[model samples]
Target chain A: MTPLISLLFALAGLASLALAMPRHAAQAKLGALWVARAPWLRGCGWAALGFSLLVRLARPDWRTGLIEWIGEAGLAAAIVVVVLMRRPQLLRGLPAVVLLMVPIAALLLR
Target chain B: MKTGFRQSMAWLHAWGGLIFGWLLFAMAATGTASVFKSEISDWMRPEVRMRTDPVDAVAAAIRYLSVAAPASSGWYMDAPDDRLAATIATYDVKDANGADEYRLAALDPVTGRPDAIRDTLGGEFFYRFHFELQLPYPWGRILASAAGMLMLVVLISGIATHRRIFADFFTMRPGKGKRSWLDAHNVLGVLALPFHLMISFTGVLTLITLTLPWAITANYGADTARAFADLDPGYYTRPRAGRPAPLGDLRAMLTDARARFGGDAIGRVTVENPNDAGAVLLVYRNDSNGVGYDGGVAAYDAVTGRLLSAYAEQRPAKSLYNLLYGLHMGRFAPSFSRWLYFLCGLALSATIATGLLLWTIGREKEGGLGNAFVARFTVGATGGLPLAMAGFFLANRILPVTLTGRQDAEVHVFFLVWGLATLFGLLRRPARAWIEIVALTACAWLALPLVSAVTVGLPYDIVGLGFDGVALALGGAFVAAIPPMLRKLRTVPKLRERRT
Candidate 1:
């Protein structure tokens, strides 16, 4: 459950980070909207990634968690790379969908 | 100054990468397979039948060892864990020349008999091949680490050469020939750069003593054993009392060891002088306990099950080394992390493959003999090797169970197929050869589970099923990759492509 949660966080983190770039934003067909939201998107992206790390490290073994966290983060970023190449137009809504997944995940965990 | 530095780094990255790319690709691919070695070993030994408690497995192993080599000096048993359903019993018995001859057999958890089991190296083959390249000692280690050092050099230079990592992190422009290859090399290198750095750096560190034994020589002069003893200080020895006595209870020793490790899993047990009065049982913690692999070692009196000496390395530098080594090995990783390690390893391999292809593609217009040689070899290294690995699996299922030197034969089949594939690559057009060989390998890999199911029954355990799953996944990936590859190749001039 935690892995899934953290992976979603990672997905959302990377998605927003990609969206923060005007080039990617324009490719997603939301240039003006992403241009206005760039700073917030960037902050959320870094913050989510950081939070995901913390969630991973919250396990009993920090070192194993840390390594797993790094690997999973890379995995999430790779998935984003694949998505960007395969269907660049989907980038407009992926971040929003993945971000909403976090709170829903929290509720499910509760 | 900056451009010059960048050019030098790029040159280093390209040339050095080519020199070691094949070896590194083999190592990385095999190492990824090695991550699930315990499961592979289990999958290979289908005759084992059942997954019982480790204690039950250990008892069966001990009985088998006692009957097989009662006069042996030592008995080493790798008891079954959750992943490996069978215990491996290895003993050292004296030969006619008074030299110790080591023998190993798998014990069935149900019957503890190895007579019905097939002789094979199982996953140990990949684990060893990665480090030894099947070469004899010292030479293999020296060459492997030399390759490893080159890998580290190339990886570092790759990072330096591609300084725009963030800017192009998500970019991969496929179907653009040289541009596509560079994009592949870049994105793969960037996303998993840290993993590649960690793996190669720690791989060098893992075999540092072999490559650079100056520290050991400086410390102990010529006695490396004494140096090892001093380094760990867990060394305990007792002279064998010539009086014959029964080997004591191992299950209790294991229970005690597990308790000592605070419920950590027990890895293996080594019993020295099992037939003598001064017998000793050493229980080591399983490598799966957390990240750093040292869960500590506890020595117990074989007769009385009394705990004697135990040690866990706590010295900062040694622990750091342990952490790095553990990370490199991934023995500490759970299922998810293990898959991550494997995925990252595959990326590392593909990064090398792309880098190799990029070089050949850049020089395609020249089309010299040297260019042709390098191009075909790259095809052989990237495409032929995986085909060879699938051949290893096919050979495992096809070879007669009773064949003498069957293990060596399986290895031979692997190399023979690899040799043939390389020859085929040399004969055919590079693009055609790549597609056909990869397609054939895909078929071979996809057929693995069916072959196993026919020879043995369908995989009964999760480990066996997992091996099958991965094999099918790899086959599917190969099949899926073909269309895109064909589409990409169609855009290029077929006549100008190298046919080495």
Candidate 2:
């Protein structure tokens, strides 16, 4: 439920969504194999987003938590977009690492 | 004015956005800075060292007020938090001419008496400038409200005018000139659209009372105070009984109020008719713990320590109003969320800047006075604001602490720098102005930590260090901007610039 962990999930989620798009997929050279897995990637992206929201909502003061989640999501998404623009190849590796790291970090931190 | 609906909306978006963008950019930038109001105030006032508990500070304030203004009409303290420990106590008293006036004191957190505090507006200047632009009376507020309304209009029209919203959601073409600027503007707008829309809506609504007072005027006639008082469900009033009685323990009332608030810390303490039999003590819970701003308030019998009435705003309309107001003011935001608000605010400012740049970028060959004005004005407003804000801080550090009208001197320096920077922008070529002012701003902001380090010796607290860190970060960002500006400045023909 920590903002940092939630932010990583959001970053993973948005990067997934961005990579699913053909234009971005081509820009990032995410590979034909990755592009072919668009639907799965999109689904995982949304699932990560939902989990991020759930993590934020898990706070005792969920009202404040929900608001912070939205703000952090925006911040996270912005970071992904800027990374995609500057170093598209960075997107190829980071999201997968984030996807693996987030849940483990969340559990350990908790 | 345009043939198509989208075109007409775009026309409105471009024109209206630029017109009010000057004030709106300033509003957003200052509002962003004011998010750390307490922290900034702490940075500005290195003199306040004690981090006293709210309960203890309230007790100290009551003790000092009891001895100093025994028969004062009322005593009020904006209870301090951990960030800024000093309490600002105001005592309502009858002046020699029989008119009501306030005795103000910046109570030392430890002693609860006025200290020889430096008379700078501190974060309050930015907070005030956000909505008021430091102008006289209702004028600045009204203008800000109007600009806020226009910002909402521009946001909506821009949304309407945009095509393929999702296709460009992640798009950013940084080196493609106009495409890049447009992409940035659009991304900054759409990424933080919820924030932008909510801020614009709530920002205007916050000042609606001042801008459009029809409802209050019609309902309460001339008694706006009564109208506002009636809006809050916990309001109370009791005439002073013509007998003297010592006030009860304010610290106990605070402890009681804390439990009453279900552990929310007290943010304000007010003692009405202190020393009278019917004296009442009111404690208000801090609004920072929640997004909703219905700060639970309780009125207590100042003589007997009995709870008189306790309530929070629960009326649907008022609750909604408080929620929206709280969102705009960001009083409830924690540090991370507050920084998000600040970044979103800066994005909005950048959107306006890029939008203004779009107008002049394509119209360089149009040879029109309007284009010329926007070209110059954009540089002044966008680049000049941060410079002027830095000057305000520099003045706070540099000014003679005991000089007469020290507060006014700080404020005057703020406005003076803003005006001078704008005038410089207007007089100089737009291209050169952008480079020079931005460079000046970078240096000014970079100078903040250095100035503070030399003057106050830079306290090692989070608030103090955080201010320095942020100032350094901003300075770094502006320093990064100067090379791009200098490179662009070389492209314009000196003769073509002279034609304007």
Candidate 3:
């Protein structure tokens, strides 16, 4: 579970880096490819990361839960940043999304 | 889109960077020094640097405290850790009229005896000054928060102004003039943007309530105490009971608390309602990962030492806050990560310095030293501050610990040295001032280890005293100072040549 969560986090980081790369022809093509396929890939990646975080949270040790939350938050923040950079207009409802997702995620995981 | 928003942002960035550049530079430099605070403290206090097994020594000290200060309400002991050598103990004593008094003593880890090495506060002074500047409560915090806000503005503006962030991401052409400095500053700032952003944001967030109290006042009603309690479950207050009770053994309670927290050592112990029946003991875990600034606190009944509650079992909101607080403090970071943080902190300081230099250069092109006062101020502040800091460390190493009013004298010497440096700068040429100040700083910093070794007879080796690491670090900083100092020196000659 930890490994899967780590992999998702790594993917999120890579995605952001790829998005942030220079807007040259090749880089733009790569970014566009990711943008085209990102919806499904990001959804799966977030889901896996969320699940692993939940698994870690359910453990008796509170430290493990806290560690998992950090991982989840980092992945979530990375995804939001990448998405916003790709499509700046997505920032309009970001605050509301954060407010909703954070409580909902906490409830579901807890 | 037609409003020239980018241009406005660039303007804001330039002005903001120019306005708070010096303060930000001081904060960054002090903050960088603070990252290695414990190590620096160890280097300064040579008497306590001797290696001794602390377990037995601490146990013996605890036994001694239990006897000597038995009538005292509560005793708190900070046992020697991996980074620190002296074990500090504080005792809360009740006077005849029922007034409370606190006494503190530092004990050698080896002999379990009082070690009155030096009265110098050591690196703690720099660490505190970085944020608080030793000013009274809210004022110091306000100043720090203002600096933090300026940093945020500078960062945002800097990013907006940079035409090509990635194109020059890895480009650094040293010794090229203002353009090179700008490139170096941009590269360092951009490469470590995430770290800088996170650190600054978290720093502001740490004091958000102070900065924006309306958020809590409006949301949580008038009970600020309750609001803070809700945010932090570890916080507890006990109603005083007039009757006194026999307090339990703190060492034993600490052992039990450590076991409960999954074998983590006790970092700090807090006793509430000391000398009363209602007194409760709270033991916190040390160096626990993910605990953030918040730690697991196990409350025990004062008399019987029965467990009341553990913070680890608190609500999710409170625990989450703790975790965030912990992450920002880097309490969980190992030795390697601490070094990384130190290096990043130094880079941040360099970034601020270079940013300030760029501003000065920009202004210089328009008017060459027209504002002599401003130039003198810059020379005094930039060069004199380092000399003052070096003097502080030197005083800590050389001053007699038992001298009457030595602590105050040491601090006075710091200010005096800094004052003299500034006066010298105003009287002399700015270029000459820079060279002289750098040379003095280099000499003072390089001589610190030798002073410590000679005075305390501690070997300068890494294994023996850990003083050499500090000496070498300080020496390296001095070495780095030479190129920049010489560059400033050469600037004067270049200007003269151009005029000729």
* Candidate with the greatest DockQ versus the true structure: 1
Candidate 2 structure quality by residue, lDDT tens digits, B1-500: 99899999989998898788888888888888888888887777778888788888888888888998887989888889855667878787777998877655667777877646787667877998898877787888888889999999999999998986888998898767678888988888888888889899999999877877899999999998799788875866699998999987777888999998898789878999999999999999987877878858999998999999999888889889888899988888877888888888887778777787887887877978988887887788777888888999999899987887787888888888888888888889888888889888999999999988898796598887788888899999999988776666665566558887
TM-score of 1: 0.94
Best by lDDT: 2
Per-residue C-alpha lDDT of model 1 across residues B362-431, encoded as one tens digit per residue: 9988989999999988777678888899999888888999998787899999999988988898888898
DockQ of 1: 0.81
- Higher-scoring candidate on lDDT, 2 or 3: 2
Give me the displacement of residue A17 in model 1, in angstroms: 1.1
Which candidate, 1 or 2, has the higher TM-score? 1
Q: Which stretches of candidate 2 lie over 4 Å from their true place?
A: B66-73, B91-105, B211-226, B239-248, B274-278, B301-306, B494-500
Worst 10 residues of 2 chain B by lDDT: B487-496
Candidate 3: tens digits of C-alpha lDDT, residues B1-500: 12587888777776787677666776777777776676676665666766554444455556666556665656676656667677666787776788886666666766656645665565666777777866899898888888888899889888988888866553455567778788768866875676678667777777778898997898888998888886666755677787877666655666787788787656666566665688887766665344454557788886677888888646666556656656556656555455556656666777877776666666764665554555555666666666787788778767777777565666787778877887887788766776777788878877776776777775755533445565557766776768877876778788889999
lDDT of 1 at B344: 92
TM-score of chain A of 3: 0.36
Q: Residue B270 in model 2: shift from native, Å?
A: 2.1
Question: Which portions of model 3 show Cα errors greater than 4 Å?
Answer: A1-110, B1-3, B49-77, B89-105, B109-115, B291-294, B313-316, B368-371, B460-467, B487-494, B497-500
RMSD (Å) per prediction: 2.8, 3.0, 10.2
Q: How close is candidate 3 to the true structure, as a TM-score?
A: 0.74
Kindly provide the TM-score of model 2 when superposed on the true structure, using C-alpha atoms.
0.92
For residue B372, give model 1's deviation from the true position in Å: 1.4
Q: Where does candidate 1 clash, by residue pair? A: none
